[model samples]
Target: MVSSSPQTLILSRILTQNEAQPEAEAVLVEAGRVVAVGRREDMQAQFPKADTLDHRDLILTPGLCDAHIHLVAYGFSLTQLQLYGARSVAEIAARVGQRAANTPIGTWIQGGGFLMSELGLNDYPTAEMLDSVSLHHPVLLYSRDLHLAWANSLALRLAGVNENTPDPLSGRIVRPLGTLLENAAELVARAVPAPSGAQTLAAARAGANDLAARGYVSAHTMAYEGPEAPRALQTLAAQGELPLRIWACLPHQRLPEAAELLKTNSELFEFGGLKFFADGALGSRTAWLHPPGFADGSGTGIALDSPELIAALGREALELGLVPVTHAIGDRANTEVLNVYDGLRALARQKGLRLRVEHAQHLRPGDIPRFAGLTVSAQPIHLQGDAAMIGALLPQHQRTSYAFKSFKAAGALLAFGSDAPVARPDVRASFAAAVTRVADNGVRLAPNEALSVEETLWAFTRGPALAAGWTDEGMIQAGARAAFTLWDQVGHQARALVF
Candidate 1:
């Protein structure tokens, strides 16, 4: 019931990404593959007995694909406390207090999506703020960027993260025992109870259904989750319950394990890349930068994986026939990853693989051209929230922050995603952010960087397909996969209309 894979005729105004044949009035599908696309009259004449559905008023395009997401985590977040638009710390505390009031004592209350700046905080938030409301129950709230975590005193105590605890490499246990940055967050997260197998499966289902409802037929799930997360997706695929195609990555630390498992490319589930982090995020004040770091005088941010380590692991990943997908958000991070990539380019090309950089959020003008021929998995929706932050913390890098136009002009495949849980995976917001270059505060950040509507659409569709090496997807053409999204208008309401 998730897919109408039988022979069918879909009549609509189709916008195929194919430059050779851009527009069509109908599409014919058989066994989940597009058999023909042409004027409605011709399709009807050719397949007179095929079942037909009239959608002449709808605009049909290739199914939307979120190029980056923590699918299971996003699903779990749907039920968690939403702190996305909280205007003040007091508001977040109130929500935590309310959740604690209904739950049993000693249970952990988990939620995220708050920005320190949005909360009007000049310094790092402390456990005391959350303690004022939920002292008996442990509470952990993540920043909007997902790179930092704020924990109540009880949560800190349970995690044994005291002032004496030393910072882990590339991670920080912020002073006064409240905030954890980068890998240090794991110190507290590891103490939290893990979701059961059934819970994981439910979360997976919720994520897939949510994306499907939002017109996404495929997702590239970034590796920030447990092994069980992918297993749940695999289970769903096995049961024919999965509604979206999944392309997953293994954390760099799991390289040995991934090699042992030897996951290969599949239409429904693919383990195609090895993921790495060159640095943290901007909102967390942890995005690695060069001299004159944060405009606020916070020193150059933390560097996660060294270039040497990335190269070594990247080479191994290539041998295993997987792409090297690194998370690089700062200029220094991007530069370092690019240098490492420079060495791997030959091997990658020899292997017929496209290297990818996740975020590529902030870049040096000189480094912009280096992204040519690479996959820049960016999240335009992030610009809505990041505009103010970029202006405030990285004014020197403003011109290149979320520079979609530059990436496209440089010939980099620009794959757009929502980085959900960091930002909502809403296609409409992506279009608005890319086309308007407007922020939540109604301020436009680098308006000159705005991309055309057609360009943005390709980033959300065709670009992601190329990044995933999915030739049959991201286009509505003969012999392509019969996955489509029906939209009232390009940037308006839309829903998945897959066969």
Candidate 2:
């Protein structure tokens, strides 16, 4: 537990984000709440008995908040065989082969984060390539976007998938034994052994602590994880072991169970939203789009949740006091989700809840304005790797992809995040991506869509706070929570400071 005694923090400067007092030299904190913000001498005189740790070289700001992440999944990813930067099929095989050599035969080897484009593959990979590396183990590696997975023959056999097996609803099994797209990935994934409850709790603790150590005070954990994920987080919070605050979402399939657990008021580990996927991701050639889809001849991507289902579930979610947070990656997906939100706007407003759309990666010009008054939870860091893909796959939608500036100008609240496990939750990388719009290939992707550093900071802090209805956070004021991020400078290195 944090110390409840009064303390005074003397800093070089505080970027309060509080319009009333935009900057301060020091802050007085008591029992995990800000008591005062003033000059160093004034605070020193006012709190004579208070303890002080002076950091005169650093800049302080409101504690950073990751608006969307899979907290437990990130924790597990930390321990998984990393393939995020594997440059070629050979490099990936080396890592898989190495892991296989150490593990006993027949064990499942799971890891991900390889981009199809990065692997220099013109077509989907085959299980035979993986078989060359791990003949005995059931190997399953996911695409960087998490929308696609590549499984070896053993893994495919274990899942009972063959050419005869028809594609699952809203998902596809790329033939000749290898890749799974969208919901189809679940076929092989379900065959993997589930993590034990203790493992889940440890992952929860690890992820929360990891983020907290990186200067985050809270996160909006988007659904896609199992029920045990949130249960573990709640368990941690109950025992005062959770370092960061969590705003969790339940999968749309679990809405009924969640509705039964809903309370009139929010709590520490709040189940505040219902998650839905309108389409798949761009990398997998599965993001639902309009006419003239991918330049590579993959048709307009797969649509996961139908508009009719979203409308019905959204209404039910709002009535039960839960926010409807949908994932819309492609332009058509965004258009469809917007249409559903239009109908539920009145009901959502009546419940004093804001509608949220995750990703919003690619948007049609006509539908861009529709995001106004809605929470646009986006990960700018994704632009680093997606720029080249966007240029190649959807050149027509390039201008609107990762449109951070346009969203804010459209009056939408932009909540920045890393979408960790998909991308590392590195704030510096997020800031760089938003401000520079520079891709990994040294190419700038729609530079006009880039945001100023100040604007990006707001998206990371104040915008997320508003999205989660966290009034006591994302600011440095007398009545606000005494949680802060001490930065070397505004967008430089940072660490959390929870009083």
Candidate 3:
């Protein structure tokens, strides 16, 4: 038996993503990169001095990568109250009351993971519901989609959000003064005290370590939080506390600042993309749809960050050697983004950069082929929750929803992720959602869109690596990173195996 060491010959049923050698029996790793991959006996004989890690009974695949996540924000949500399964507003308020009973009277309380439809609510909830329980404490809870926020009276007052306050462009202050949608949520979010630098660092560590614990070797963090978020992750990496290799993005609005770090890279972190949102999410009733809007009579949803802005800033992002990543959830939004990307593609190709679209959730059939040569960073886990909503809210678009197989057929580079904090980064959840197209409500959203297990695995691994431009990751080949995921069963129990 060989003892564990930095250099080891690991044996397993290797699913090498390299086209030349799709499978291998063994791999030789030194430092943190693969030195060679070949048959078990040949590798063992060649590297007799190298320690051996025998996992011949397990399956070894390229390292898993979450292509979209809000790392620091998700970390903070881990400690906050989780409102994932609540079926009623009263239940949510009770949970808040219990937390208030133990906390300081004036502290702000935060939580998320509730769907408007899941609660069986016919209308936007009122602040009075939360006010009844924690009158003194400011309570602010976000909808599962992160596009809608419900604030208690105190919190709304703190943010100076009143019934008469005009809604910010592309946002809504839902009447009766309790819910904030889209950018409007930021009004109250600003009032909540910021976590201290130490707390931020702790959260960064928590998120990164949590992903590592779940067998993820790397992640692409979306720019949903403040600059402090990425800074915290960088600091954690600098201190040797970060567990996952991170590809972080900055908001397109932060491109001027992003330009300074154009060529940033290190062992564990790199600034890779500029993120822009073309529209909001479905659960929040804010997906910018085409002519036929929400069936619930909620007119065509809000559009954020105009196409002009995306084109201008997106070109600028590409010039600075950054990927232009846009979040587009509706057909119209996707169409518009695709149109803008048409002009930017030439520049992106010249720079060896791939334009990326996040949450290309609902797309028109005509626009599907336009994704060729682009990265579609998506979260199938979201389908579990959005399934019923899609059927009820936008039935006309169901056929094209979560079109994973179609994306592959169209030559789009499909990458899977959990969009953590929006949903848990459970690999099985992603695998099941992609492979089955089944939703939690016992109904399949779009059966035709289901992906095969191998395709799903590719999305979770190599697809993300390609999107992030990480040539050395997401494959088991000489010169590739030695990070891998060992599985008892492909979609079952798994763990990170890094040399």
Candidate 4:
């Protein structure tokens, strides 16, 4: 179905994503690499000996890349019970009840994608609410943000967690013995059995192939997943089963292990970042915020990783030729990370490394200019779900929520992603949300922050390529990979084209 050798393509239009030669009517490939790009007639005449494929009816552009994703986790989530649309506790219980019927007794039943707000709850769901429906089986469901976990009594019991259980570092065992926030969620999570190697490989394949099928030729896999996750992806690549190129990271704590990994790298996979978390997600009310954190009197949110460790580890990452990437959701978190980044700027520049801030979701006006020359790896699709939440929870930061345009103006390279498993890798949703700034409730969160179609495309393409230090990707030019995405329209339906 796909060709590995050279071929010439006659296209209706090619958005090159290269500034110098931004458009071309045709491209010539050899050895699965771009050889030339020019007028259709010129390419056809010059490459007469080459086999020609006519795609003059469609538009071609650089293949899409979901700059942020949890490949293995997304694969595992494919088979999990989905609660992304459940609006009430009864509905969620019914679904969990149905799952319990199918699952054997005492076995763990896991699923997620529900929001406390969507469930019409002002607070976390209690263990009692899920106790009866779980049929004595351990049940665990995560909030849409992945920062909060709702567990049935059995799951909590299995995890040996109770009201008297002291909270884990930077995490909380919420009241009533049902909700687990941040690191505490790991307790119940660790209690669940890990998937077998076969399952891991299968999930890795599923996640990569799904992205490839959606016209994504590359992805930047975050370090949120377990070690088995990257190992599975590596196995897939070694076997030639991986269809997408991956730029992966290791947690800051994994620096010792990272050196062993960096010893070897491949075309399809590379360890390029050292990941850090400055705070948790907004949905769980765990986002480290400034004074007057949550309007509902939730207090300033919890801080996770300390700044001192980040700076110390960051320098090591830079010395090791890896990017230092930190996740900052709340304004206070962003400010703190920026401050740390400022101190590292000299060493980072000397090392020719660019610091990256993931999410950059909420920001202060003063923090905007500081993002200059940094990478803002943001997910525009988050706006649709977070718009109302931002308005309700972090009102003071509303004007700066998902500030794409502002980041760009401040000299930050914008690399857009879906943050898969946390959100669907829907390009359409990303395009629409970034350009329209419209939320699910039909409210525009920050219209002034919206990006143009071209800008959004660059964020998805060139920006990510540059962010990952892949000069040959995210553009259609001589020496670039022959990968391209055929689209019905600029941001509409898309499919990857073979050589």
List TM-score per model, in order: 0.98, 0.98, 0.98, 0.98
Off-target runs (Cα >4 Å) in candidate 2 are 1-4, 263-267
Sliding window of 10 residues with minimal summed lDDT for model 2? 259-268
lDDT of 4 by residue, 214-250 (tens): 8888999998788989999999989988888899999
Once superposed on the true structure, which residue ranges of model 1 sit more than 4 Å away at CA?
A: 1-6
Model 4 Cα displacement at 184 (Å)? 0.5
Each prediction's Cα RMSD?
Answer: 1.2, 1.4, 1.4, 1.1
TM-score of 2: 0.98
Q: 6-97, model 3: which lDDT tens digit per residue? A: 57888999999999999999999887889999999898888898888899899999989999999999999999989998999888988999
Q: Which clashing pairs does model 3 show?
A: none
lDDT of each: 0.91, 0.90, 0.91, 0.89
lDDT of 1 by residue, 225-330 (tens): 9999988998999898999999899999889887665544456998989999999999899999988899999889999999999999999999988999999999
Q: Candidate 2, residues 1-499: lDDT per residue as tens digits?
A: 2554556655568888999899899987887888889999988887888877687889888989999999999998888889998888999999999999999998999899999989898899889888988999999998888999999999999999999999999998887779999999999999999999999998888899999988898899997889899888889888888888788889999987985656522345888899999999999999999989998998999999999999999999999889999999999999999999999999999999999999999888988999999999999999999999999999998898998888888999999999999999998899999999999989999999989888888888888988988899899998898888889977779998886
lDDT against true structure, model 2: 0.90
